[model samples]
Target: MSLALDLAPSASVEVRNVDLAYTRKARGTAPLSRFAVQADGAALASVPDEMEVRSSHLVRFSPTGKPATLQTYSVETLRKVEISTSGDTFIGSTDDDLYVFKDNKKSRFLSDRRANYTDIALSESGSRFGTVFCDMLAAHHTVALGDQTGRTLWTKDLPFAASAVAVSRDGSVIAVGGEDGDLWLLDNARNTVLKHRQEAAMEAVAVAGTNRVVFASGGGAGVINAEGQLLWFTEIVGETVALGTDSVARTVAVLARTDTNAGRLILLSGENGLPVWEIDYEDSRPTGLSVSANGEFVGVSLRDGTVCVYKLFYGDRLAAADGEAVLAEARAARSGDGSLLQAVALLQARLGSVPSDFRACDLLKETLTDAKEQALALSANAEEIGDFLSA
Candidate 1:
């Protein structure tokens, strides 16, 4: 795939304190794959019982990669739940009302009414939050910034349904994107910092720690800094349904559904929006994504009621079957064979990926060695094809 960046990339940008969940070892000739679908996750402090798990639609992770408890907040069936960045304040929305749990008190912010809240976001300090509200009685939509006490600080009517909203770490800037394909950056005083539009509906939007904002949709994803400059934009291959952003590491994790309901998860660098790592899924499309622990681990929710977590960096546990299958197929190909051309193409694709594993490099070396062995063993009646190619 071809990718273009609006600004020139820096010399180098590495994620801070990246960790690998899996590991690979060279015990023998058969090395393991670099990627894998882990069934288990980090240690759990406490979680909802069976009944609560069934009703819950979203999952959150703490800074230590453990499941975050709502603390004193009572949990049950909830449409959405959001906690303040400081981890003290908790707010959740049900089918009819909104609740805020703080200071050992749970208060109802919104009474039982005909209004519906689709999305809610909290600032880092828990001092304020941003939300998108839709009125069921009529076709009216509004986005507002509210204090911890449920007081509206600022509000605006949107041309489209505001599907996603985010507040910067400092609570001075708010980023809101709507289904009308518009993304706007607003100050705390309701001043527009940046205005952007795309061909597809904007579903996933976030405000980075550097005061930069990111927005993604079926059309593509892009980053705009606080100065209203487009840092980078790239057209993705599939419909980006959901995404996760890491403010500390400055990374964006996109979950896209490709052909045949297959899922493609790509992690992009926040500096230039370039892909840092990627993996694919089969049959099930992931609908939810969460990045935690400074981008060390990524957790995704699939349509098949399954949740998988993966580490961002290199490790020792070898379980990526698809990658191993491709390499094994390439190893079986010899010179002058029809599959030789196809094998080279596959190997190049693997190598093209930004970070490659040691097994892939070793396979390339073995392929050339196997080709030479086959060529030397040619029959007397067989015509020589010349020297074996090596790089």
Candidate 2:
């Protein structure tokens, strides 16, 4: 699990299910909501009176959105933060600089020649790091490779600014996703190995193996071999909202329309790009998604600042056993003549595994909307799942 990458912007977290499927163990909004931004540069929330404009730091929030104890830094706004697999070193980025934290000491520098860093990545070994620099005046984007001590290794200009970047486990390969819908594979020396182009931007890229690359885009998810041939492509209808942060068992990705919150979380084999299973989570607008390296957990963060995590169960019979188990529990809950509160608790339990059936998702929505006619809106049911959707 040496690979780490960043997702698009949105508010914080809520749910804290650590069961056998998707699991963020929580998600809560950060006191510093500037991390959640609109692509159009709209206002989100104001900074606290005690915090200074230059006093930048990364705050850890429990799934409930309350601040947890963590270290702090001075890179204003702290755009994106990633740590090595060892969890000893960390890399944080800003619009113009990159910060490296190790051994309880920190160092900062403007990486490479370009500025306006939009995205950041760190290798699993914590030996290497990279940045996506956007030169707005020149109308182009650049990628920079560097070492852990705040040193720039090399910079490669891109046809367009990159939307995301990922580093391989061994720290030898780098994947860059461009706004122009191109995926570039670069070696340690910055040589281009493969360039896969598409009509949509790449939301994420992973080094599945030596020439095996996994990518998620607006169209769908797929894999390619060293020769750059399309190994397999799963056609998705709209934009890819988030991708599972899978470095070992690359198994899941999220898809949804840009204009709506309806989304599909697809678990694929990662071998042939065939669908293993899919779940519908209309819980909230998914801003981020990823599966644990062991393939046992999946996490989805919604736009309302709620982070929902699920623990997964595996099976050889991928067709129905996995999904059937979910619906079975839902049915059992209803057959027991369970109260709506119990259903909401079960709803929180199956947050990400609500079956591929849209009816279950519709039920959550319809039940939440009936708040006008019933007290359910202000009940724990709302606090459970309804709270996120209201945002």
State which candidate has the highest TM-score.
1
Q: Model 2: runs farther than 4 Å from truth?
A: 1-70, 111-114, 159-161, 248-250, 255-264, 280-283, 317-391
lDDT of 2 by residue, 129-221 (tens): 877777747587888888888777888888876888877766788888887788888988999988888788787776644556777775777
Clashes of each: 7, 27
Model 2, global lDDT: 0.57
Question: How high is each candidate's TM-score?
Answer: 0.67, 0.62
Score residue 74 of candidate 2 by CA lDDT.
46
Candidate whose lDDT is highest: 1
lDDT of each: 0.60, 0.57
Question: Which regions of candidate 1 are displaced past 4 Å?
Answer: 1-5, 8-11, 14-47, 51-72, 227-229, 259-262, 283-285, 302-309, 314-391
After superposition on all C-alphas, the RMSD of every candidate to the true structure, in Å, is 10.1, 12.9
For residue 375, give model 2's deviation from the true position in Å: 35
